[model samples]
Target: MASALNSKIHAPGNCPGSKADARGGAGWRMDCDPEMHVKMCKKIAQLTKVIYALNTRQDETEAGMEALREAHQEELQQAVAETEARLLQAQGRVGEEEALRQRIQALESALELQKQLTQEALAQSASCRLETQERELRVEAEHAERVLTLSKEMLELKADYEKRLRHLSGHEAPRWDRLTKEGPEPKAEPGCGPEMREVLLEVERLRAENQQLSKDYARKAEELQATYERENEAVRQAMQQSVSEALWQWQEKETDLRKNFQAQEAALQAQVRKLEGDLEHRGRKISDLKKYAQKLKDRIQDLDVQLKEARQENSELKSTAKKLGEKLAIAKDKLMLQECHVTQKTGDMKTERVSENEVLRKENNLEACSLHPQQDQNFAKECPCTKGGTDTQTKKEACIETEYMKQKYEEDLRKIKHQTEEEKKHLKDQLMKRLEDLVKKHTVEIKSVRSSVEAERKRLQKEVEAQLEEVKKKSENEIKQLEEEKAALSVKLQNSLLEVLRLEEFIQQNKACPPRGDEKPQELDYQHCNILETQ
Candidate 1:
């Protein structure tokens, strides 16, 4: 505004010379001291020169201020651009993290799928093993049945041999007496029957022992099957522990990835904050320039009024000089009072212009002073000339614009913060859901496996118990047959002993009557060998 103040003096059309000459002729010159007029002219000349210098200085100051304002505005635009770029970069990073999260989720899903497949495969394998074991048990049971049939055949054969022996014992006594009484000694080994009986008994005992061994082998096979089940349980536990460990490691890796993403986001936020600070300072500078321009416009208008008054005064001075030429020395005394009035008017105009300039300068300074606190700190550092460059309302507008931008940026930051939090929560929820699914799947699989294992164990145990009962029944039947055969053998030995004792007593009674030895031998001598029941 100060730079615009040029040629702004107002003068009235009634000048000192013109007014003095109008009332009296040369009295205009006679009343005013000639020396004072010359002094005033010299003063005006010096003051004009000073005003020109001041205008030059003001122009330079204004130019410099304009350049500074433009530079600050450019800086503000650059800062805003940088801030926007930073925000975009942060958004990019957030997008990248989201993508990574998606990929991680996909990976986790794939792993879960693989785990499920593996579990299914394991179950199938376990079923196959059970089938194989069942086949083995069936084969063992078949072998045991074959051995039992063989034992039964051997027992029937022993019973047949005992019946044949009893038939021979019943018929042999009459044949032995005839052979001894009618023939010269027909000597054949008489112990062949006993030898054959001993050999048959040994064969039956061997068959019984073989059947017992088969029973023992079947019992051992059942024990081995139980041991196999225990081993399978231990192996299954080992696999479960390893699977849990791997899942735990994956969770640790997931936590590490999340922490890294958060750290990068925090660094980006710091960069954004620095840019926002610089943008606010530049906005304040631009506002200052606007107010300065307004001040200059007002000053220019005031100068136009000053110019119009100056032109009218110059015309009046010319008219006064013409009137003074007409009324020379006669009006000098009256003109002195008119000269006094003109000087008073000139002084008043100059003083008023000076005061107005001072007031405008003060207002500009006050306006410039109304800067943001943050800008003021920087202005104190970089721009001392900021004081008197603009008006108060211009600074106020800057403050408002800065506040609005700050609020907008803060709101955006808040929105971004909210989105980030929500995304994190969403990701967490997804992770938790996946974890729950894994747990549920694992739990279900474990329960199914456990039930299957239990079912299989129970089925195998029942089969083994059934086999054991079958073997017991077979053993009891064999034992009963063996006891019956033992009792019959003991009865045959007792009958043979009683026949030998009776024969000995008869022989002793006949020994005292040895006279008829040559007479036909009685058949009774061979009777001892004729016991068919003993056979």
Candidate 2:
């Protein structure tokens, strides 16, 4: 196009060159007709107008490029901010995840501790039950032994009484038999003798003695039966009372164990409630963190969309700048052609016009050279000097802003990390403190409960021992009294036997005297004499 425009402007027979000037080149003239000069002037005027329009378009392109560069920088800053925000959100999520894990671990540990405590408490309770059962068994065994001893003593006393009764009966039976065999010699007499009357009196005394012995035997048997019944009743009452006391003690111990278990349950429930509340709080935090992360993702998406728009606009501005550069080159060529035509008409403007043309040509050459490279360079370096200056300045500002944002992001990340660390430590401390307090409290409670249980058990043991001793002493005293009663009854039996022997000897003496042949054997009524029925 420049070659065609040059051909049109410097064509033959159109204008006079400097070499063809009249008067030795001091003045120059256009060899063209006046009409052609007018046409050329009009064309120069039109070219000036086109150049002016191109200059205006170039200014507009520069302004647009500058604006686009500023917009791009702002978009870059926004993109950096979005990236930083996303990074921060990610970091926050990581921290939250870690915190949640820690909390879960803490809760798990607490649960394990609680389980262990519960197991220990159960073991302690089980051991306590075993001890109580053993004690009860021992008490029952002791009671059985005591009862057996009392029964044995009673049986031995009964056997002894039976042996003594049999011995006394055997000795009296032979004596009675001998007395019966020795009958009195019969002598017939019409009148009664004094001896016969005396013999009759002795027989009457013996009959009275037999009746008295029978009455005494009956009374002693009734007394012995009554004493035995009373001793049995006393023993039964003592056993019943001991059993009742043992039962009451067992009930009290059971109640104490139930109360302790209830207390432990309440404490565990409170701890569970606290743990549930902590879990709920953590859940809320997790939910909030999720919401924040979602918001950050949305913001990043928005920033991505905005960045694409900025890039699209930047490309459009580059294309517009390239088109404007082409238009400027064309306008520059037209202006150069206009100046050549004007300089050919006016001799005085030759050197100035040539210099101006040379400068315009150089600019055209540079623009043409940079045109292809502009596609790969993003038009930043290959752009017009003024445009390049704006691009470089804006780029530097964007870089500074990005670096600042990076530094700020790093600082924020550091702060967040520090805060998260502190939070973790604080939470851990609180958990540890709570766990320690719970452990201490549980230990104290267990100790107190165990001490109380031991004390109660000991007290119950002492009380039972004292009751057993009292029962023993009472039983012994009753046994001693029974033995004394038996001895007194035995003495009475011996006296009765001696009286019988004396009566028998008197009868034999009277028989020997024969009462003067028993002048008259008075009719003795023997029907009134009867032996007593003994048990």
Candidate 3:
């Protein structure tokens, strides 16, 4: 019994009994059986070993679960990142398409504008050509009329000269015939000879004057013809030069317009080609995105299956841990019951006195032995609770963040809306002001244009009236001059007719006298010759 007591006092499992042995001494030790103490110690050792194996198995299972969780988290993060990247790419593509569409719309507008400009240019050119052509035709017609009028005037002057020459020739022919019928006047008297010589001298002077007038008239006609030809040639050259210059300017304008139009067309064509290529590339990218989405779907499905399997394994581990914990509790309860019976037996032998330090040490040892499983169970329980707590906290924080974002967004939106309204109002006011200003400007311009047009019309009318008055005055002056010339010619013709009649009367009187005698006839002829010469 003493050896058993010594062995019990030294055994690791009977540390609490050592305190009692120290307090009760040998008397308390003599009450306990050695065989029972040894059996209790062996049972405790076996229970501790079982507990250690359970704890190691649980730790290994937890380690495996932790690795799986980390892998799942990594996969989830990778998938999330990939999906986010794809979404961003899709958004970028959508933006590009929108931009391309806007560009196409702008190009179409520009093309329409170019077409309108070209059409306007063409219309203006056509109108300009028509006006120029009309002006040229009018100028040509006026020149033709002037040429015709000059030709008619020249023909009339030629006719007048011929008629005057014929009249002078007929009058001279009658005088010559009278001389011939008389068979040459006899120079029988001295007074007749002097009178005849004076008459011949006057006749020679009149013929010489007639020849000088004809030569002067012919020279004046030649000068007028040369001046007319020079004027016509100068007018034609001016018209040709003006027409050629206008044609060259018009051709230059047309070439410039064509070059600009062609350049615009080429640039637009290049833009269209570039747009088409971009659209094709976008189409290819869309197809690639579809295939990537399909791949993501497959990967998500696989991840879902893995998650389900992990969930099942976790549940199974939890159930196993619960069973093991229950079993350990029952074993600890049985060991506690045996220890209580041993303490009762020792209490009957003597007063059971336990030291405060030994009780504290015993409690600490019991806690240490059970701490692993209890802590594991507690940790397992706390894990979900902590996870749920963290999840709730995160959810709450997320909700608060979302609410804050919403409030901020609303505030910002309100501010933006207010700003937009202000901008709109300002723009509206500006537009209204601009519109009013434009209306006023246009109205002023219209009034000014109308006033200018009226003034121009009045000025043109005054100018035209003045030109007409000047033309009428010039025509009237020309008519008056022509009439005066006609009157002078009529007076000269009457004088010539009277002289011819007088000469005829003188010849008749001479014939009637029948040359009575040479002296009488010579005296009568001398009187007639003196009358003719004086007239």
Ranking by TM-score: 3, 2, 1
Q: Each candidate's lDDT (Cα)?
A: 0.46, 0.49, 0.54
Clash tally, candidates in order: 13, 0, 0
Q: On residues 1-535, what C-alpha lDDT tens digit does candidate 2 reach at each position?
A: 4345545655554445645432222222233233333443554455456556646665675676567567656866876786687678768867876776686567546645654654464455446444544553454344334434433443454455446556655655664465467556444344635555665565567556545644554454345334533543453344445444444554454455446545544554555455446545544554454455445444554455445544544454455445545644554454455445454534434454456557756876786686775553553444456444654553355345434543653464466448646855775686567557755765675566556655655665566457446645654564465356445534643454454354346334434543211121121111001111110
Candidate with maximal TM-score? 3
lDDT for 142 (candidate 1) = 46
Q: Better model by TM-score, 1 or 2?
A: 2
lDDT of 1 at 123: 53
Task: Give the residue spans of candidate 3 off by over 4 A.
Answer: 1-135, 162-255, 314-535
lDDT of 3 by residue, 296-351 (tens): 55455545544554455456445544654565455445445434444444443234
lDDT of 1 by residue, 332-436 (tens): 222333344544543444355457667756865675688566765564554334333433433354345434543653464466448646855775686567557
**Model 1 poorest ten-residue lDDT run:** 1-10
Per-candidate Cα RMSD to the true structure, in Å, reads 34.8, 27.7, 29.5
For model 1, give the RMSD to the true fold.
Answer: 34.8
lDDT of the structure predicted as candidate 1: 0.46
Model 2 CA lDDT for position 220:
47
